[model samples]
Target: MEYGEAQQEDESTTKAAYNPTEEDIIEYARFLGILEEEDAKLLFIAREGIAAPLPPEWKPCQDEDGEIFYFNFSTGESSWDHPSDSYFRTRLVR
Candidate 1:
């Protein structure tokens, strides 16, 4: 998959760091499917931005067509365009 460009701006909203232990791996494997060695879960979790493995299931991305596609969240890569900082404003009320 192709990745978009990264933009920078003032930000404070942070994503909490999470570490996955052995049990976490097992749970994640249960969701992503177990590998021959059951070691690929780490890769999958990392690919999914693995902010603490929680059941290995989450709302990974909201697509361009307004579809909620579920998958592993990759903190490394963003699947869509999101304001990386507070410079941009989000309008809630119409």
Candidate 2:
């Protein structure tokens, strides 16, 4: 069987199964305008069986333009520039 077909079959045999294609995830991320293309791609890769977990000090944050980035508190760095002096923030904030 093709790799995708096998994956779908395996997923179907499990409860609460919902396997999303890479393209689908990327498109959805783009639609939400929450993640920059590269960030979205990295996220997709991370979700797809990357051996290591994302850095513990890294958090998902968004810019004023609604583009998502990874903010590393330990390093005081981000995947993209954010407003100075502002805490790393996400849309989930109330």
Question: Among these predicted structures, which one has the highest lDDT?
Answer: 2
Cand. 1 Cα-lDDT: 0.35
**TM-score of each predicted structure versus truth:** 0.25, 0.35
Kindly list the per-residue Cα lDDT of model 2 for residues 1-94, writing each as its tens digit.
1121111112223313446666655554444343654464345432332222245665545455555455665776655432321222232122
> Ten consecutive residues with minimal summed lDDT in candidate 2?
1-10
In candidate 1 the C-alpha lDDT for residue 62 amounts to 43
Reference-based lDDT, residue 51, model 2: 24
What local lDDT does model 2 show for residue 59? 51
State the C-alpha lDDT per candidate: 0.35, 0.40
Clashing pairs in 1: 47-74, 48-73, 48-74, 49-73, 49-74, 49-75
